[model samples]
Target: MTRSTDSWIQQLSTLMGDFYQLLAKMQYLDLDQGTIDYPPYIDPEKSVDTILATQLGINPEAIQLLQRLPYVAAPARWNHGAGDEEFVLYGCFADFRKDGELEESRDPLYASIDPKDESVGWEDEDGQYMRPWYVPLSRLGNHGVVLILNMKNRHLWVIDQEGGCSDPGLSDVDWNEDLVNKNSLDRYPSRPATEVLRDLMQKFISLEWIPGGIHHGYQHHHYKRLYLAHGWPDNFDSPAFNATRQVWEDEERAQYSAERPFQDVDRLELWTQLPTISSQLARCEAENASPAWHAQFQGGSGRIPYESRKAELLARLPGEQQRRQELLRELEQARRDVVGVSGEVRRRREERLRLDGR
Candidate 1:
């Protein structure tokens, strides 16, 4: 990039960094309460809402507690039959515990809830779960949690201003210095964390962080805050850390690429961009009338006939099922979200009316 563009980028990065710091300070000072009123939200099940309220000591509308993280996009290419185009954002504050490898070097921070061994539950009949949890992508100076509220495949993810990915392995996670450098470019690519996190955070803050609006009218909510424990647990040891590391290695591969062969497409930029292009292709293909249109000759009829060879090739494509399923699920969720949100609004309005003796 030209020197002039580079200088502008540096200025922008500095400004964003400063803004991030300001947001952190505001959160610490509990300024969010004054900026927004977190009323209790309504859950699909009233009993679930009650339990959430009891555990959180606030209405469910007030906060959301995420248990697991999924991929905003999957890794571009890994050694798996899982397509090289997609990337997933899964795991808890998992890698931070890095087999306890970094504990000796840096103080070990723990999650409020112990990571459980039970199967992570799904929220839908298709065995999909849509919990909005914050997944940290980097340990950027270890100041705060980098989180994304994956709102059940809705419009977009809601991200926390202070939360970010802390994982060293994630391609999206970058050194702060690199971010500053990129900002210098005319078409400076956004630091993956900043772009992804900032976009998600805005969505989360504006939509109340629940995807599909399923929990919109609920009167209670639960949000998990990443906190620094005063001290580490006495029982935390290498053996436990080793076990956790193994679990991450085994589970991350198994969970996302279980049916596919694993490969090495874990780079962030490639993974994020490729799948998007692929997905659009897939959608266009699905809606297109003739599958063999691509093979048409220069002077051939636009009315191309279906070709078996092409159909076979598509059928053999990797992650075809998963991709189609993801899109369908998102579409379905969008519909349900509209209904759920509207119902909650009506429900809340009625409640207000009753309270006013209407």
Candidate 2:
């Protein structure tokens, strides 16, 4: 092996050791069956001597690096929330080889065209190059990031649906640092497979160490906040958390409905209920004068009664009607102004023509 290759192998070994230790500490191997005897290290160079070797034109160094890492068969349930699942890392590119040639069509990440077609490669609408050799490293349920390695440059990339293998601006020398700084939303380049695995293991450890908090709903903003607060949980399958989140979402929906009772009502439906709403609004306004009503509504700090909302709606109806009338009047005025201007222009043109004729 070249000096650089030797260095990479050594670094990979250290990272693998760290990752193995983390897995052991988390008792992941114990939790999952049939992975106990899985080899801890891979000899990427010699390991690719299989029948399919001739088909895959991948560098031996890349293969060796892939083999050095552990292949997770059954991913452990690390989280129990919706869309938050354990990260499963695996290496399997045999399907890419068919009839002793790279079958680009077999992989969804890559284009369906032939790999030998140098004129084209996988890319987004913006024409940014997406590395075709994306080996899925970890997944959060059905969705997750894939690790792509540039065999020639020996640079690693982490990509997903959100962002493909494109780094914002970071040097290759500090690749691991850049990866560590990346948030769950970011898709950027990182260190090789072993280092990336080690980083993921660290994140898993951090998440496991954090004591479970109040379940937040599964909105993007909520999820982003939670992810920032408590790194993405390795597993979100906690029945308790899931139940809590569901209840929270249900409450939110109910509260939204309570706040906007007329939101679902059509114009005809709203008109039909106006009389009743007006009567309720009057009653609510009258009740507002009483201390008991104030206490019941907690001085208007708590949820506003439906009666109060109805009253507000009734009050705003006339204003909305007046605003519509005002808009109609303005539109008529604008039409008149346009007509007058056109007539004036025509008269001036006629006068000028008459003067020229005279």
Candidate 3:
């Protein structure tokens, strides 16, 4: 552990405690006495696995943990503090598989195949050679302030590590070519390594998985504490009632019944007009073999025998039949009117011929 970055590494060990505090606060979680005794952030004399099991509520034996390069930040260089300044930043690491395999090793080819490929012997090569990449966490330094985040959980870690203006060693200086190779920049994780570098750059300016720009929408959170506490970002101005209404309507008109029905009856209002009687008849005819379809349509107020349902549909058919007859009568009258008008025009033409003596 006598590496050039040993002190920085030790600083990381210390920093993990602070990072853990931030995560705990973000989740609104509390540590039990056992967890307090053995936390995951710091290296205890005992196995870290035992501690993770006690604290995180997961089987630590099953979980694989990897140490990422610690994020570091250099002091700000101030030549009298103008708008622009070069700040040296450090202390960023990524979590990945211990074996250098895909994040989702169970499914190496995660993305769907492209349908455009039409070669007779061609194989799906898009996700064929791809590896699964997931759940990136990043640490960043802007100017002199360091911002670190666990993207999946939306945890933010901040530390002001910048040395004061009096510290010259921490500020900008001539770099030795020898030292550059000795302590190279650590690599970040990406689907392709380039994307990882890009993400690392953007992490300082933005947080991932969060909606950007002026408008924001719903984001589902599984952790109850985080969901209930944060309540949705203020930028998400969409009314909850309206959003819920649309969801309900979508469920109602959906081809299949919703697996999980909305329990809030007051919120889920259906349209004033019920399913049309004709539509019901059509559905009945199409789904005659399906008992489930029969149960759905024939349930509740319309509970009756199949014969009775048929009779009810047949009972309404006569009214439609009567309307059809009325329409046919009107069509006949219109044709007669046209013939009478033609006869009158013929009579007028004959009168004109007689008057002209032709």
Which ten contiguous residues of candidate 1 have the minimum total lDDT? 223-232
| Top-TM-score candidate index | 2
The Cα error of candidate 1 at residue 111, in Å, is: 25
- The CA lDDT at 182 in model 3 is 19
lDDT tens string, model 2, 105-201? 1232442334345664333222224233333333322333445555455555555544344332223433233333232212444555655555555
**Which stretches of candidate 2 lie above 4 Å from their native place?**
28-32, 36-49, 74-113, 116-141, 165-198, 208-358
Which regions of candidate 3 fall more than 4 Å away from where they truly are? 1-18, 33-268, 271-358
* Superposition error at 166 for model 3 (Å): 40
lDDT, candidate 2, residue 141? Answer: 26
**What is the lDDT, from 0 to 100, of the residue 47 in candidate 1?**
15
lDDT of 2: 0.42
lDDT of 3: 0.31
lDDT of 1: 0.31
Give the best candidate by lDDT.
2
Alpha carbon lDDT of residue 299, candidate 2? 61
**Segments in model 1 whose C-alpha atoms lie over 4 Å from true places:** 25-198, 207-358
TM-score of 3: 0.24
Per-residue alpha-carbon lDDT of candidate 3 for residues 100-139, written as tens digits (9 for 90 to 100): 2213222112233322223411222222211111122322
